[model samples]
Target: MDRNALLVGGAVGVVVVAAVTAVLVPGVLADPTDEGPIRPGPVDVADVSIAAGPATGETVTLGIETRIDHRGNPTQNVSVLVRAIDAESGLLATTQRVDVGNISRDGETTAATNLTVPREGGYDIEVALYREAERVDQAKRSVSGVSAIKPPYLQSTTSFTDTEALPPVSYSIEDAGEDRTTLDLTATLTNTGDEPAEDLSVTFVLRQAESNIVASRTTVDAGTISAGRTDSVDATATVPSGYNYYIDAVLMRDGVVIDTARGAANLNPTRTISVNQTTEDVELRVEDFEDDDDRTPEDYESERTRTESSAPGFGVVVALVALLATALVARRWRQ
Candidate 1:
């Protein structure tokens, strides 16, 4: 009940009230409708697919498709980065960037790009989604056996007919003599493509069955053949008689061999042989030794002896002549 004490207590109470009001008033008066800073929506790589494109000698193009899913608020300046890394070497083979622009809706958007790489090994394809130059999500896919893809130039439209029912190579004996035989070789080809096959040639090689020696070989042009059509080319070969031969047919285009087939020619009348059959040991034919003048064996031996005797030394010749004269005198004394 002192006046100064009561006044000091009142002042302390007022200061405490003011401090509580300062702390609580702003939080109570804050607007409930206010929303905080606008953040970008979530963008994710939904799916990824890859397809093979045109192929050249050692390189090929791959088409990459990336699907992005957008949720929440709209996104701006979206893009997809595709990379091809060699699986074995862990080195980057190729890369490409595709712009997807703005993605406003909450759906999927596709981004496509092409990546060219060597057609030798497998690769790991990586797709990343970027928003305003910032990466949001990424995905990966793998492909193998790239070397199985064939180039355009090496893809042949025509091939030899090889089947159990039909053979590609066949031969006919045109003429057969005592020492030689002539064959007419035919090679059948099938064009399986949509376009005509041109600039083709076939080579016929006649190899002896027993010796594997090339007896005769000939090349002939194969005319243009329509698509889905089978045609034959002909060649002639003259081989030695009394032997079996294998007729090999080689199909070529622009000097490159595309296909090959084999047939057989049985020229021997006494012994029959085939290309796939094993060869039997045969007796070799030999002739008797004779002189160029058609002399017999006895005549040759007599001539050889006479030439040897004529080359004897002078002492040997004088001894022979004296012996003959002594023999003649003894014969006369006996008479």
Candidate 2:
């Protein structure tokens, strides 16, 4: 047994030495440029910081401002991702991703990521700008500036009311069914709007590739949305096979349609929200995934199970453990 143990130890040493030699070979070592240079172009992300924002659970948003180009074009399609690490162990805790829409005409973009952080703690964020798939530029954030956050999902809106109604509308069975369909319908109405709405009637307009509707209502409603909160009537239609269709939540006031947008509902259980719908042919929205978490329950359970099962392995280690156990057996000149 001792001889076999020595042979195994020798083999382990040889393997370790070979691995070291392989790493030391020429062209094997990493280049010094592995740490890429931070060259911020016309846009500056100096203020890009991660903060716990208002989401149901532990959600985070990166806040930042951009320095515009001389032409006053804001940085388009900024991708900000945050990865939280354990300050004590330096272990990666969580990762999140967000996409900020086109920059303002003044070349300014704020740090609002679609990524949701499921847990709370210190995190490091990377702010990047991309044109297509290629990264045009990016910047890393410091952990010190990462603000701590807590819970409560509430939006303070003095202008908007909690309870509102919709206009009376009838549906034309353009095309739609359980197997194949596309529902397209239009609403006509007016509004009694007093204040401008942050989320106008356009917000209720649900346009999905699965559905197509051309709503040309003569009325612009009250102002944006408030002018057209009326009662909802059945707007049903037959959806055609493979035809694109979307549910548009409409608003009406005094029998006239005002704004569009606000009819998007995920009630069918399909994960896609048609956020790709464009205003002026551009999409400007971000959403968090339902399964996103700082640490999944399965991961936590797996770690615990491994640790618990490892107790026996420690016993094996103690058993396989090499110890110099010497015994001094004295005898009185036994013949």
Question: Model 1: per-residue lDDT, tens digit, 84-105?
Answer: 9999999999899998998889
Expressed as tens digits, the lDDT of each residue in 84-105 for candidate 2 is 5545466665565656555555
Q: Give the Cα-based TM-score of candidate 2 against the true structure.
A: 0.24
**lDDT (CA) per prediction:** 0.84, 0.43
In model 2, the runs with Cα more than 4 Å from the true position are 1-42, 54-78, 100-104, 114-121, 143-335
Number of colliding residue pairs in model 2: 49
